[model samples]
Target chain A: MNRSALVSQAEPRDFIALLKPRVMSLVVFTALTGIVIAPGGVHPVLAAISLLCIAVGAGASGALNMWYDADIDALMGRTATRPIPAGRVTPGEALAFGLVLSVLSVLVLGLVANWLAAGLLAFTIFFYAVIYTMWLKRWTPQNIVIGGAAGAFPPMIGWAAVTGSVSLESLVLFLIIFIWTPPHFWALALIKSEDYARAGVPMLPVACGEAETRRQILLYTLVLAPVGMAPWFLGFAGLTYGVVAAAGGLGMIWLAIEIYRRREGAAARKASGRMFAFSILYLFALFAVLLVEQGILARIL
Target chain B: MAEQPTEAGIVLTPEEKRRQRQRNIAIALALAGLCVIFWIVTMVKGAAILQRPM
Candidate 1:
């Protein structure tokens, strides 16, 4: 095929891939939880709009991340097939797509929801694109630790969409994700240390050895276990949430311990993989329980 | 009358051209839906859209 023909062959799916749909799903879920948990009423349509904006904003962040990290992504096995790296979409296209979506998401959110939420959305795009992607990812082993705040903001932004202001409650939701990120990501980093090392990214495992990474993961999980139960203790969530959070937190800690113990061979990889997988479910179950308690159960009872 | 140079210098296969048409239609429909949403929001908010908060 000719050059222009090859360029013209870029499909809509390539654009979607730029969005990082999996990451966007997590953002959507957490943001929805925030919307449901916030102590107020929002029109269903407006709530839907707010969620759309959050999802699009998340997509924009992913696109920008891909644009910036295309080089490193090409180096990493796990990311070698991303749109930009695969040559299905150019970096310029991804940059323009991201910039357009970022502005559109923020503007529509400001008009439809509230400015506070929109501002938060804009800041999230900036934080992920500039601070995390451009700076921390290349510079520090604590990249995911500090960069996690960008992901954590969606819930707060969702909460602000309704309340027009941040509250202690919203901060609690933010804290849960912020604290949860390091251990969750570190587990994956342990499994993918070679990928990070190859890509020249200073992930904890790549920079500090696997043992230290495991130790930090255990420490973070220890802190997260209690904080995960905060919604229950704070009285916003019901007994269901408290029980689930406690159980899930223990499960996470157990998995982290397993990860810490099994550190030599395929057993270590399996343990790390299990911990990473379970961490996702742990967060999802915690949020799902909270959503049911605050949003559904509250409405019924 | 005229075929505009939207994909200038980029020749597309028939399948790509078909997909492009589909995408264009989808985008147009989405824009229309957005217009409807804007109308509904304006109607719902009414004076509040312009009102100053004290």
Candidate 2:
């Protein structure tokens, strides 16, 4: 009688990893900001349930992504040891797991929260699993640019889940995420060009060359900084989010400039890596300020 | 790195064939569970869309 005898096949770790648990932290946090900040109140239970649905929907997308990209995962050093690739779970098993979770999430959201959110959640899963993974990923260098819309939809969906409709304020959040995505992604691409090339993944650095990729990064950052401040201008968020977003935008541009000046070697890698790390923090801090601003506003109102 | 030559169009091995049978059964059971969940949810509430009636 070994302790693991009852559940010999269904390892907990594979299941947890399927959810892309690390990315879920940021997704959940930003989504919570969208939910709490949108004008109107959500029942505490409904809010919790909506967030749970969003989490499961995100996890479902990750599992489906792992399933679809199992071939690529086995090729690339970075992803070669994922659950499906490692034989911890078969690709078929991973697909089934993702499909089941996807449907369950939509149904749960529809019943527990609202259909608007359920529909958005359904679309997000489809966009990531099918649009990005199945189509855009292998087809073009514009993959991340367009595929980024899938990730950006969550904040807006979270807003609609609370307010029960889309609004200009929610669209501001969407714009920020959409604009922030390309520069954030290209920074990682600059360092991983060789890996992507070896894996036959046509990333920006490999497809367009380093100098061009760097220039695109700078251009996108230029656009993103102003977009990040949309909340401050619209009065959807407060002065705090505005100021912090401006500082983060400047930090992003500084890092992009450093990457632009440096060679595409260790120096550029370190600069791009710093930008990647700061990008995560930048998005989170901005959203956190939005949540705080909303809390203050609610107290005053 | 050489692109590994694989039997791309084929999805059937002895092991895969056996696994496919079990998978079909599993899928049926899962679909049944989903249908049950769907019914229960609808009984719990009406439509999910909270829209203004015009």
Which is the leading candidate under TM-score? 1
Between which residue pairs do clashes occur in model 1? Answer: none
Model 2, range A21-105, lDDT digits (tens) per residue? 9877877887888888877786665677678779889999999999998888888777888887777676777898899899988
Interface RMSD of 2: 10.3
Displacement of the residue A87 alpha carbon in candidate 1, Å: 1.0
Docking class of 2: incorrect
Where does candidate 2 clash, by residue pair?
A: A115-B48
Q: B46 in model 2: Cα distance from truth in Å? A: 12
Could you give me the TM-score of model 2 versus the true structure?
0.83
- Which candidate number maximizes DockQ? 1
The CA lDDT at A287 in model 2 is 87
User: Chain A alone, TM-score for each of the models?
Assistant: 0.98, 0.95
True contacts recovered per prediction:
0.14, 0.00
